[model samples]
Target: MRGGDLVVRVLKYLVSVAFLALPLAAQADELQEAPAPDAAAPVPSSSDTILVTATRLAIPVDQVPASLTVLDKPAIDRAQDIGVTELLLRTPGISISRNGGYGTTTALRIRGAESEQTVVVIDGVKLNDPSASSGGYNFANLLAGDASRIEVLRGPQSILWGSQAIGGVVNVVTALPAKTLEGSFDVEAGSHETVSARAAIGGKTGPLAWRLGGQAFTTDGISALAPAFGGKEADGYINRNVSGRAVIELAPGISADLRGYYASSQTEIDASTADSLEYSLNREFVGYAGINLDLLDGRFRNRIGYTYTDTDRDNFNPTRARAQTFDAAGHNRRLEYQGAFAIAEGWTLLAGAENERSRFRSASPPAALATPVPAPVRGGADITSFYGQLSAQPIGGLTLNAGLRHDDHDRFGGKWLFAAGGVLNLPTGTVLRASYGEGFKAPTLYQLFSEYGVASLAPERAKGWEAGAEQHLFDDKLVFGATWFQRKTRDQIIFNSCAATSTDALCFVPGNATTRRQGYYANVSRAEAHGIEAAAALKLGSFQLDGNYSWTVAEDRSPGANFGKWLPRRPRDTANGSVSYAWPFGLTTGAAIRWSGKTFDNAANTTVLDAYTLVDLRAEYALSPSLRLIGRVENLFDETYSTAIRYNALGRVFYAGLRGRF
Candidate 1:
């Protein structure tokens, strides 16, 4: 069938679904909010609601001594974006640089920290890939379809998350089942032959609550590089994902829960030249099971969980037919136990223990036939950890928090980390908060056992502090917040130059260390980053306005050729804002703007990346109580720009879709 015909058929089907929900509109008046449902998720009594990620315990946002942002289901629906990174760009202190448009290599930097320094968690499983040289979570193929809530904590959290939390943490939670049977489906088609479809079913039955979801997406993406720079062909991408969760009550105060997610994608890539047709296949799986027990009449809670994660990746040159160019697989297993107890009327204690093992294997063909073929490489590591935290309300309108952790690695022995913080409330809805924390990151398998790996490297360390103030006015209708943070890192690892004249100890040639230099990973640098983040919001009746700005100064303080230079792909200034209004007729219209300042593509600042501004417009109409029509015009101004050197960004695009629930 022709592309035009396919789009027409999809449009008709979606319209029919929307109309089917019209009959449900007549019963809308019978709907009522449910009672206390999910633990760690308390019903909101006011705008300043409570969240669980900040402390691993339910606490009000204004009372937590940390900088955090929560993007709930309603906020996500307003954006109407398919990719997770697209929505994250509107968050404060978050920046991204992707090599191309959709399904490309994307990196996220939080609060002037490197992309690899942040941590990402879904459900109870950490998303970092052990096989990756940088040991970071890739955001390229992460879609927003199954995510019901996302919590961003911006600061060092090693005391609670163990490793790779020097920058911060991102926690994604899936939607839970409602009391009654409910299901939803959405379909969208847009520019570049792009099409996306998603469906979900969820409800509670007797002692069980469950949700199942699936999504399919495809797009003929733009070139990875500009035509002027030799890009000649458009890369394409396809993704399929499935997610599920279930909870069953064993008895009156005991429950068991399970969660799983799987995703697979094939993304076209560019080689040295523009005409190359290379593609990569990626598969990721995460699953976990846990049992929760509430004792002492709900004053004490305990959880025991086990998690498993696996990943497989391959890159191939389709022109070469059956020849496999590269292949890799990684697996991780973890067991954990946590407990929370109310020690006193105004104090609570939190503690947890974890054990994890990670393994990886990889194989790659040589670049030339004459080059000797290398055998497959294998590596593994084990880690054990214990952590404790105390939260106290020692005085009126004041809260104090302190936490500590100890980690023992199979190779590196042991390390200790800690964090201390407090929040003070003043007259008329004013809050003051401050926190200090230390973090550490262990070497990845690729860094210690790969072909050019170095096993003698030590773990990198960091120290950081932040102070912030928030003011609420007009009964929480208007809010203003600002935070200032600074961080210093020691023994940062980086690939060193391999020039013959270089004196770096870690850059020695294989089997001829005394004569020549060869590139290798080493921990030989110190760096510093400082930034200011500010946010404002106004809500009055049916209109809402929100904005956030970040001023970051990220420099390499190492004593070398790149000393005191700006970090790559990090702009000095960035801001995001949106103005939205809802009509009584069940129609909502909104506009959003994202602005980024100039950035560099190299440590020497030789390749300058032009700044850009993007504007998007969205509208939604409720066709019935259970159906909604959504439309979005992205890149409304058609601004030509690039987040990375040589890459071509997207142009103007339009998308229309409908969502229906029953």
Candidate 2:
């Protein structure tokens, strides 16, 4: 039998098994990073804090069975990082690679998983560009504009989030009005003629609350290709963004919400590893509308919502006759209903159903006018899903959860996933956690119908398990944690290259024996990953310290020449550390260090990516209760480095800004 036939048989078996265990995954999709109506706000210094990303319902951090990191406004401001991706790098279980400086193509991977496997959510709306090669969100344009909190949930999370969540989830919650009238602003300028300015205003009145914000940033950046590669031309970048959110009361226990986010960016790129006068334009829009209602005296809450996302991308090469090289657009629309019911004091049930539709159209224009632009490749897919989860506390300080999700895809049909985990919090200030999760990723539209696509590809599947422990001492002043995790993936999708003398049946385009193809999407037999993550935080008097380390070994374990080789671009070790102190005179100073081990640049492990370290210094002075002056020197030592081969990393740069809140 051929590869396609074998995939069909396996899928049928999984579908039958999914239907056998359908009802256990009952979890709501409310995604309230903030507390629920009845749950009180979390105190910054508390050991047990509330978070909702794990199960999409408010729960304390100790009760969550997975590893998670929360960055509140104070932390975000103190870090003084301009990009959200930069902020995430300080946390555990995450790694990043960028082609150049700000506003360049970026890849963020979690726990050794592929970049496309992670899911990004903003204010309860999912983000991805289906028209892209891998159908993933680019962190290049994602900034920390007007964001109050951001959560990083590591590991497979497809039980609550749907497909493409094999790695984990990044949940970002923007600011919401809390006072009758409030506002804030920030302005900064730094090296390379970089300037950034942003402001926000919001207010809460009787039955209405609203917030609006905007940001603008520009920089003359370093070369896309490394200076070591004989590249010297500068590449510039600019970005503009706007966001708004509103909640209106409709009745005693009901309300409606409207939210939107828009961003436009332009970045100068290069021709391969050489300098060239080329550039790209990108735009992203996210909109959501929802209504909330409560019944049984707030014991049960329900929400119905609609979300839409659109991404537009274009590339121009001035050297070409037409200049315009690529154009693409992707759109996603989703209708969902979510419910959360407090079955009892320590027991809860969450459920949700959703229908998501994705469409994409793309084309590459030819240089010569004699030939017309090939008819744009257009494709669309729909996924209808129902999921549920149950959590209960049968004994003091012990919480357990189980969940299930079933998805019916227009192309792949039915698939189901299951997850179970437990957390034990002891009176001795120690917590133990363990979990098992299942994940899957359907082939992207581009992978199935594009010029080099194979229409008969199957979805990839993965399973992972983790165990960890945490200890807090001295009234939560000193805390440390570590986790060990392992995962296996089957039928991983990869691009297969056909050699000139190859005789593989797949070398020829379908239905045309004479037409040989250079490359096509195919499934890898297997892959494996395992790692250890350790983190600690210390708070003593006016001084504080935080640090994390990761040891990841992701390998291709298939029965081929590449077996046991390290996966591309995944370092075996990475670590981050920071220390800060505050003086009695309203001054705070801090320094940070980041280090990474060497990594392979390709699947065959023939190319080597050297490791490097960087240092940074930051300081802040409080002018008043609501105002402050901030300055930071990034890459303080001007250490030259590269995250991706032949790509230059930012060197020494300085920035100073004023922040105000009211």
Candidate 3:
């Protein structure tokens, strides 16, 4: 049978299974609807910190059955990182590859999963661009500014998030207003003629709270390509961003929220060689409106929201006399409802429904020839999904979570996903956790109906499992954790060369194309990724030490000639360590080191990137009660490293800044 026929059969079976399980789930839910009874409070063995992404509800971070990390404002400030990429690089089980310096394409891989497989949420808005070659968020222009916190959830998380969550989820929460009226400003000057300025004002008055912030940054960066690649000119980048948020109490137990963000950038990049002059202008926008209601005297909580996102990119090759160029835009609109109810003592049920519509358009302007611009490729798709999760603490020191989701896509019919996990508190500050999850990614519009598109392709699928243990010592001041995880993916999409007789719907050669290759997207057989992550943290007096190490083996296990080969751009080993001290005299100092082992740049492992290590230092001093001075040196050793072949990495650089609040 053909691939299309097989997909239809599997989809039918999946649909039947999903329907069969719903009644059983409904019955189970009914049993939990008994009268609420007071249950004995469970003893807390883990930290009290909370994370919202683990189950779409606030819960203790350490109690989560999967490995995760949280970075608060203080931690982010002390890190002294300029961009999101730098901030996430210190995290365990994460690796990064940048084509050039700031503002260039930067890709992140978590636990051996590809960049596009990870989901990014900024203030409740998804940032993935459906029009891009690979459907993922571009981290190049995402400068860190006024962020309250960041949460990284590793492993599959499709039960809460809809799609493209095979790797994990990264949630960025922007700063919000405090109870007291306060405002702050920051200005910085650095190497490479870089300059940055940021300011924010926020306050809470009565039952209303509001915050407004803006940031501007510019830099004359290093050549994107190495000297050998004919790069002799420096690329420059500039970014401007503004955001606002407001929340108002509507009733005794109700609240309303409104938020919006806008960011734009103009970046110069090298195309093919250093001699080429290419530039791109990109803009992003996100808007959200939501309402929250509390019922049953706080026993049940519900939130309904609407989100809209727009991403646009325009690229120009100025070197060409005619300034050849192309532009694309993508829009995503979503409506969602979430509810968390205390079904019974020691048990909570979380459920939600999401309806999303995505649209894309792309066009290439006519060149020097007196020709007309071609019509844009336009397409749209919709996905309707319903999901539910149950968290139970039937006994002391034990927690269990189970979730399921059913998604109905306009083009591909329906599919179901499942995830389950548990955490057990052991004796004397020890905890054990285990989790298993399944994920799926629907085909993007460009892959489904555009040129070289395949409408018959099925969604890519993944299954992941992890187990870990943690120990707390010294009155919970010091902690250590170790986790092992593995994931397997099937039916990955890849482009293949096609011949004249090819009957595939996606195979085609345009009249204006330069190459003779006609290609189409096809499903690759299989791949596997497994890894070990270990972390430790110690706090003594005014000093703190933190470190982590990861060993990843991402291989192409497909049934083909490249089987058993190393996956491109995934390093076998990565490690990070940091130490900091705060003096009684309002002075703080920190130092950190990051290292990455060798990695392959190609599927066949022919091209390689050697291992390299970098050292960074940061210091801060309180000049006054509400004033501070900060300085940092990145790449102290000026080590030469290549995350991507022939791409130059930033060397030793210095930066100094001042911040004040009123």
Candidate 4:
């Protein structure tokens, strides 16, 4: 389709969706503003809400023009999910493709963006693996053990977050101590012999606060490959993780904080051709230390921090002469200084400077131990960045924000970026927002210096804009929102295959340009994506309803055989809906449904992947003020589906657990 035609069609579709929201909102317009059915599930009002990820500062949600979703502890608990990625699927404009079951490779995408373009941040530390081809963080090992908050910022966000923010950012904040002494725990067991246990203890003293948490999970999972596609044995998974946080007040206006997270996992995997006795061991660690200083009567706040992340991965085949098949490690060290100041009565400033160093080592061993393994492949990169944003409320109910950033890469040189946005809040319970952002991502170490790498590849760049509106009715009992966004990316990186008969220089051996090779990395791709997201939440007396729907059109605009074709593995339409009832007593029951549209498995759009839907039922009963009994059945209908072609997805499963908060 032509670009102009596509835009017009998207606009019309958005208008229709916007109008559809009106009737949905009106259905619950009669709901009186009574006391919340569940105190823990209070209604949210963006006008008075504080969002921290918009600019790395606590600003009112109504002042931020970006499209975002916030899931707090209460919401997290209500979902009864064990994986962070699963919980995020409840939000708008998001999709994921997992190789098999839990503990397998998982890639998360936001608004049809490449999975590698999404940056994952945990406790102020960025998570990425330089050894990986895309250098993106894997979500398989990340579980919802002790997460207290999760926020997703959609669309281009590089103005604040440096690289890998082309798709967006997922910031996860764990628990912080609130009482002098407190603890929490959750444990569950279910089908496939799956079991998950978690525990945490924390305390806040006179001048210090500390918390530590741990979780262990195991599952006798389904076959890695679908039964219809091939025969396979049951593949199991095991994971253990620990996280901690500590804060100390050294003086009246000075403080220090430390945070750490570690996870180790073993997952059984299958070769593309057949099932095997191979397994992968992965370990991830993150550490951060920061000092905070408050000045000018708390008007100015400053923080200096250092963060480190390490990821180690290994694969083994018990049947082979040599147990180890592969080994790789990636490390990142970063230092940053950030400041937020209330410059004036209605103006605020957010600024930061960051320096990051990344390194990687990788190797694959032979089956025979006696045969010496090749030396590991090693590489590194450095990036220095400076950024600032100005937020002003020049008049009542009006907010304008603008930001600028510059990044200097040791290999890619320097690049400048700018973003601007505005928000208008009306007394009639309406919010209008518009934003434009630019994103940049340097080539990964593997993409730059590996055997398949090209030294002259250019960095990927993206430009995007979004406009949306949110409407609240009946005293926050009914809320509806819709957003339309468009993004264009250039010089996107992709692997290029070389024909055996072709004479491309990049397809030859290092010393012999005539010797044909397999493939090489190149910057010959361009893409365009446009989407619309709609969300609604309604609370009527003891019953609550929530739903989100998204329509995305992502296509390759490059000059090639795949031009104008849908991007691989991205569904064009997806929706999530749920309904819950809160009893007068201490009992709650809910049901959720998720539907994903069909998609292509390759860039050429020849391979088709069928669409599927899943249903889940959940119930929770409060035994005491500090404890709750929870039970849930996922994939309730025993639906057959596939997120990735030929890869098996989880089936029906049951779990019951107890949640304690003390």
Candidate 5:
């Protein structure tokens, strides 16, 4: 049978199974609803609700305008058995592309969007590296233990956020101060000689509440294929990370949060022996502080935050005489103020303004010239933006949101962006939503000012629209949603071959033609991507089944370019599903599978990465109210596959650990 036919068959079987189990699932639900005379007044379950930061405004997950997914604390702990990359690989409509092992450079693409287009935020602060080829964050080095929750929002978010939000947003929110004294400590040892320890404490003193936490981890990564020509035994690398955070409640309506992290790793490049000759040592340190205040009779709110990050890399390549060393540093600071008030019987208004500034710098040694060259090149860029958003609820079950932003940079010119969206709630517990927005991304310092034998570049821009619906069924036991979206980008920075014409030979002219990318990117054409994302979570007695599927069709419409071709590294179809059973004995067993359809490796779609699937199994046993034992087997079938072409992927792995709370 053809691939399409197989897919249809599989889908049909799944639908049939779901229908056949409906009766049993319904009976289980009825039993759950049976009241217990002494059930303590039916207290609310903590797992029933989740809060998200997708809107910069804290709101319940179901109320968010766009498609949102929240991995809460309990979920995070259970998945901690695997690396962050592996856990994210299971998310719907998301894909991770890796260059090598766990700690190696990694990128995330959402809904056919490029890595540079996805924005990553830690505690509401953007973490894009200005010194990188593209202003994008490296997720490989992030520590998952410090996050209280991970919120993934799909679709363009430029109006509320600024640049680098063309694809979507991933927000990692850290733990906050608790009202009661609490503490926890955890330690784990697993495959690949991995070991880690973490501890946290929280307490309240009169009007003040505070929480502090720290973690340290180390690992010896798995082996893989070498890069370059003629490489060997691609193994033997060490990765280490340390992080800490603290939150303080200064008053009843005021709070401050401070966090610091340091991560360093010595890893071997999976290149040919000639390529392996280059060993890399990377080190990074980050510090941040934020303040929040609620005032004006609880109608006005304000937040101020600042962050500083420094990353240093020392690469020794035997093939090249000049060892490449990079000292990159960046700082981000922002201040936001918002207020909301009731105007009439059924009307409410919300408004906010934000001021943000970002700066980055990098220094690297220039490669040796055939003869002799001048000193290395050094430069940096600064950007400042002002933005505001408005939200109104003029009638029951109807909400309208609009936002605008202006960004001015010392390097790139100015950009103005805006978005408008609306949500309608039906009487049957369903919501319909639609949004249209504009997005912009400034050229990286490297793209604009890199001294590649003298070349210049320009910035990129995007426009997008999304429509979706969400429904709650079986009295909220099941939640389902579907969304369709499209985005078009302009002036996409690209490297074009330069013509060779040397006027002066005194500079020791290199190859036939000195290659340099031109900043003259044009609005060649447009890229259209439309997809349907469907997700459902059903709670049956003590068992839960959650699954999601995304089908996408992306085409490049630029004239003379790879028109009609699928975007590189984007899967046309993706799906994830998990089934968990919780026993009264305090044990939970679950298994999950993730699958991605075939994808292209380049814009022309000439080379394809075959479709693949991964399976993971996890079990957790509650030793007590304060401690638990968790174990998991990842890549259970030991399938060997590549998330990116020519990149090494982790093989079968197992982890066992213990977690506790007091």
Candidate 6:
């Protein structure tokens, strides 16, 4: 009866089992009075509408204005047997952190920000990693079965993405080409002896069309963390990945794409306590090419890009025999063109322009003459942005969205971001929304020239606002939503306290000499993140009840700090729910629950972590008509908690897989 009364008795037993399964999920949607003569038959797809391109404009996630989440492609082939951080932690303000297991180096945080402030795009290029000391994009060596869809955009998208997006954006779209001539393959074995395999092929000649795929995974991990100078043994780790992609339609609407990827991993670090036999090996390589054009008679659209990233880090220790290699490489080329003009009836017009350049280099391996030596850096940066957006519907159901962007930075020089949103369509299918935005982030190169034994760094900025409402009942089968937000930041590059003497040689520095970080940082701070989100989806027929609840009060008003604490890791309550079933013998069952509340880990909120709930179960069986067999049981009551706070999570896990189509 401790730990806040066991998180209030597990949130009162999940709100009393979601109100006792709400009358058997509302009597399984009534309509069973003898109607069985070969019933389950309906397959003619052409619109249940769920198309999204994360606002690079290709709307329809209920007309996206913001806060979008889509995981299509049959839910990524039914969660491909878990571990893309368990399918993005079952979504809902996403959060994932891993320091060990399944490829190490995995971190993603959204809504509470950080992880290079979120911006990872593939197929539209931009995959962070410039020696990623923080420009995040190590989706733990991403190989989620060559993702065909994954879009998550939540709050502050820097006005159509520019500059780390200030906490939002994750797009990985791939797989297209093959209207016919198909293929498929799979193999699996699980439970810590995990063996896996996947394959694919597609075609169409003359007028060209193509598709290709590949996958490989390995694991031996679990157990490795004990080195703030201590000891630990048998760290266990291994991972490998390979990928390839191609799509060409060339002509009649033009299309072209090429992709290649490589990954490598190894980890085991305790690095001290008389050197507990240390180890660390990390490697990554990526290449991409793109082109998409569809013109006028088709409403004009164009995209061109090139991207390459390389990373390598190797550290082996036998009592510091000194081997700590380093490598980081990046290249980006861009061209974008957009258009939409039906400027007469109900109006629509959007525009775009972008030019980018980035380069970086870092090298290390010259210290151990007993420490004290650092220097080896190279840098480059360029950005040119211009954007425009407008949408209108003068009357009928009213909707108007506006956007503007202008960014030019070679080094913190120009900024202008803006957005306006609206959605008001009420005739009982309610919806009324509002939005405002401006966000920015710039200054990294180890924050403008790295040097820790001698001090130097700076760059941070932001501004934002939002408002919303939505509802739909018994036709949309019950759905609801609400949102409110606000943000403010300015030159907030922190690490304060510098003013000391006593033969000051920067006072023999090595961090926190009462804090020393002010390389052009300004602090007139303010932060107020307000929120209230509610959702419901009920389509009873064979049982389906989805739910969501979020309540946040992220605060921080600075003068001397700690205005009302509660910023770091921002969690003031969150929830997610699910209850699904489909049984006519072919079976399909589901159950899910997730919750998080107490959060704080610095930023004056004073360390605290206690609030947790996670339960997941899934099942599917249909061994015919293109086969299917899936199973999942993650943390299903084996809960030993720790979604980060010394990090260690993965206690009750099981996965089964099988899929086929041809």
Query: What's the TM-score of each model vs. the native?
Result: 0.91, 0.93, 0.91, 0.92, 0.83, 0.31
lDDT (C-alpha) at residue 317 in model 1: 82
lDDT of 1 by residue, 491-526 (tens): 888876677778776666545658553577889878
RMSD to native, candidate 1? 11.6
Q: Which ten residues in a row have the lowest lDDT in candidate 2?
A: 33-42
lDDT of 2 by residue, 180-274 (tens): 99999989999999999999999999999899999999999988888888779999999999998898999988989888999999999875569
lDDT of each: 0.82, 0.86, 0.82, 0.85, 0.66, 0.61
Model 3 alpha-carbon drift over 4 Å, by segment: 1-48, 498-506, 509-517
Tell me model 4's lDDT, rounded to 2 decimals. 0.85
Could you tell me which residue pairs clash in candidate 5? 226-270, 227-270, 227-271, 227-272, 230-273, 231-272, 231-273, 457-519
**Candidate 3 collision pairs:** none
Question: Candidate 3, residues 535-564: lDDT per residue as tens digits?
Answer: 999999989999999999999988888999
lDDT for position 300 in model 6: 36
Worst 10 residues of 3 by lDDT: 34-43
lDDT of 3 at 218: 96
Query: Which residue ranges in model 2 land beyond 4 Å of their true spot?
Result: 1-48
Model 2 clash count equals 9
List model 5 lDDT by residue over 598-642, tens digit each: 988788888788898889998989999888998888889987777
Which residue pairs collide, candidate 1? Answer: none
- Per-residue lDDT for 41 in model 4? 16
How many clashes would you count in candidate 5?
8
Error of 6 at 272 (Å): 23
Clashing residue pairs found in predicted model 2: 25-388, 25-389, 25-403, 25-404, 26-388, 26-389, 27-350, 27-388, 27-389
In angstroms, the error of model 1 at 239 is 0.9
Query: How do the residues 297-404 of candidate 6 rate in per-residue lDDT, one tens digit apiece?
Result: 343344444556666666666554455644455444444444443334445555555656666666665537577435666666667676767777788887777888
**Model 5, residue 120: C-alpha shift (Å):** 0.9
